[model samples]
Target: MKNPKPTRQRERHNVYRRVREKIIGLDFSPGSAISENELAAALGVSRTPVREAMLLLTEEGLVEVFAKIGTFVSRVDPEQVAEAQFLREAVELASLRSLSTPLDEEKVDRLRDNLRRQKETGEDIRSFFALDEEFHRGLMDLAGHESSWSTVSAAKSHLDRARMLGIRKIPELGRLTEEHHAIFDAAVSGDAATAERHLRSHLRLVFADVKAVEEDSPELFVRDRDAGPHRRSAFVWD
Candidate 1:
């Protein structure tokens, strides 16, 4: 039998993860052209994996590749955001309902730790973003349906940039932690109804966030889906 190497697959996935995070984190702004060769050079890999990764992202609606021009990060779609909101609210709220009386002490303590870390993140939006995700995933874990979080996470990618945009634009970072506390308290106190209400409200805040972010960076999302930004060279940031 011939020896098989798995590192190539891992390399491709690493490239994908890095690129996807950059996209979701808004490091690569919407509509910014992404060059495969440039990405390969930056990641210390060859273009093959970079190209493959971009293809995978294309299937996920995160990247757009035109026939001749180039590949670029897709802009935030309002429809996608709305749909993602609906799905996320459904999953998180249902998870809340699934919580039995007397939430697990360990998970509750972990959530407390998450909230404390969230408070300490201060103005570091990236750290706060990661913690925000962890808090919600913790909720799912408490409900004993931790496996479902992967589905929610995958479906919520389109919604992330707008959420990230909202976080980055708003100077007061503690507001999110406050909201997390509300959800956590309601869940742990055996008030599933209130927890559901709080979680729904928190998830739907993205709509207002979308509006605000659109006002500040109109180019990040087209007001109308039919209209599109003119393709520019990868070097253009504006």
Candidate 2:
């Protein structure tokens, strides 16, 4: 008999990935209500996989389960964002400092291509977002530490939400694309110092972005630094 464990595990992960993507993309906005039946129906899957997926997300602190209420998307927590940012910045900067003087021209070409697409992406936030991820991942690959991107990525759910908000709020999105160009040029020319400087600056900008977005959409963020699920409408309060 064929073992169903692998297939089941893959299906659960697939469901988790899709749901997590939607959450990060703000389709399931922070602090919003989620109906298991609706979500399962929307994804064209049975409730079992969806339930398992939400369980995984809850473990990741991305979803909250309120007894006698419902499951809710956890509000963006600045602390989590900061922690994730710290992890990403540390790994990326360390990689930058360890870069070889002469970067691979082929890798350089891929980064260039990503930047070109980013420039051409214009104000298409979602498309630009994907390109932005690709550009950064390309940088990691260029340093031959491509495996590090996954670890950086897995820890940055809140950061991703903040970035989505920031991308939406930025008046001139090209500014980020330009930063990518600066980092890429510096790296290709074997200028690790300049590359690291630009990369650090670029990565740190998320602090301001998170602040700006929180100001604009206060409801999308956590209520307080220390709060618990209240009797409120699927939200946590102190």
User: Over the full model, what C-alpha lDDT does candidate 1 score relative to the true structure?
Assistant: 0.83
Top-scoring candidate (TM-score): 1
**lDDT tens readout by residue for model 1, 1-238:** 2558555678899989988988897878888888877778888899998999999899888988876678889888878877888888888888898889777899899999999999888688888889989999999999998879888887778888888888777867777788899999988888889988988888777567766776787778846666544566554222
Error of 1 at 143 (Å): 1.0
Q: lDDT of all predictions, in order shown? A: 0.83, 0.83
**How many residue-pair clashes does candidate 1 contain?**
0
- Candidate 2 minimal-lDDT segment of 10 residues: 229-238
Stretches of candidate 1 off by over 4 Å are: 1-8, 223-231, 235-238
Compared with the true structure, model 2 gives a TM-score of: 0.86
